[model samples]
Target: MAKLLFQRVADEARPPAILGRPGCGPPDYFTEVLLDDLVKSGAWLDLELKRPFLALWVNDEDFDFPDWNDPLIAIDQANVRKFAAMDPVVDLESLRGMRVYHDEPYFR
Candidate 1:
């Protein structure tokens, strides 16, 4: 299911993130249940670190989680320029090639 969702964003490239936010559903569902399942199940799977996913757990005092979101950014100056060069008005289609999985509210 996750792979399919990512493939929808970029057929050949990897996206930066896979956001899990509650939308009209129980807040606990996104804030707790999913992470619990992942932690228990993550050990069963094997994944490489390169081109890896930087999972972010949104921290809110009201909704606590067993895990925390670790900062996953590790880029040089040149990559910053490459990202900055993007023009939202003209380069909307270029995101796929960039492999940036944004965690902000869903938008395309």
Candidate 2:
């Protein structure tokens, strides 16, 4: 029963819409799911660590900021420089397990 429900949820779930600027590649469905789970589990804060730098999503409702580290631009950038300089495919796959931060401070 639990397995059936999990499958159902997975099937019904749609990837989060990527808005604003164009992204470098296809939508990261796995990252979206992990982000959702982190939000639900209360393990995520507003700040996310993409790699070497820290960043906060500008407007999660409309768009997700490119993941990055302090002194780093994008997660892809850090990954490329540090890990997958020669293999893009491998770098993309590695992104799935990266830490995603949420619950950023909101200003009115």
Candidate 3:
């Protein structure tokens, strides 16, 4: 399902704002679920190392994602600038506007 969605974005060039936090499907299973699809579909996926956030884009214009306003979420200086250059209007002052899930550690 996620692969098909991303493939559609790649095919049509309409990138949506993809956001998530700790436990939800996105930031949680990003590496596990989305990376392969993004790569296979030939779309761009910018993974944030510090914080669990990522952006998807096929073209420079349709790029979209949230900015935590906190440096912890930014990958690096150059990467930050690259995202800024892609779409200069995606300014997210806080993650309050996005759908986030609190993750609880599972102990066995």
Candidate 4:
């Protein structure tokens, strides 16, 4: 499943984005949940590691995930950009932090 999500994100050439506040609650599991959803939907895109913010991009520009708006996700887009700029090779690290889980089986 992790490989599939990575492949989808790499193939799509879009980075997965994540957002979170400083010292927030437990490592939010939303990213993992969303990753499962994206893979199931066959829309998993690239993973973007912007330090405080990690994001997942779908093929569509307006694609919206309820998780994106979660307060646990980052609230400031600038912070995300800062992280991205600081480390261009952010995806590699982001992928490592991701914890793939076994949820409802997804079929495409």
Winner of 2 and 3 under TM-score: 3
Please give the TM-score that candidate 3 achieves against the real structure: 0.24
- What would the per-residue lDDT of candidate 2 be over residues 1-107, giving only the tens digit for each residue? 12222222233324322221134333433343333333333332211132211112222222244444533235333433332222111333434434443321211
Off by over 4 Å in 3: 1-5, 14-81, 94-97, 100-108
lDDT by residue (tens digit), candidate 4, 9-92: 333533342322234344444444444333334432223322222433221133233356655334333333333344243543
- Lowest-sum lDDT 10-residue window in model 1: 45-54
Over 4 Å off, model 4:
6-28, 32-70, 76-79, 89-108
lDDT head-to-head 1 vs 4, winner:
4
Error of 4 at 57 (Å): 4.2
Candidates 2 and 4, the one with greater TM-score: 4
Candidate lDDT scores, in order, read: 0.27, 0.30, 0.33, 0.35
For model 4, the local distance difference test gives 0.35
TM-score of each: 0.23, 0.22, 0.24, 0.23
Pitting candidate 3 against candidate 4, the one with the higher lDDT is: 4
Clashing pairs in 1: 16-100, 16-101, 17-101
**Number of the top lDDT candidate:** 4
Model 2 regions more than 4 Å off: 1-27, 44-108
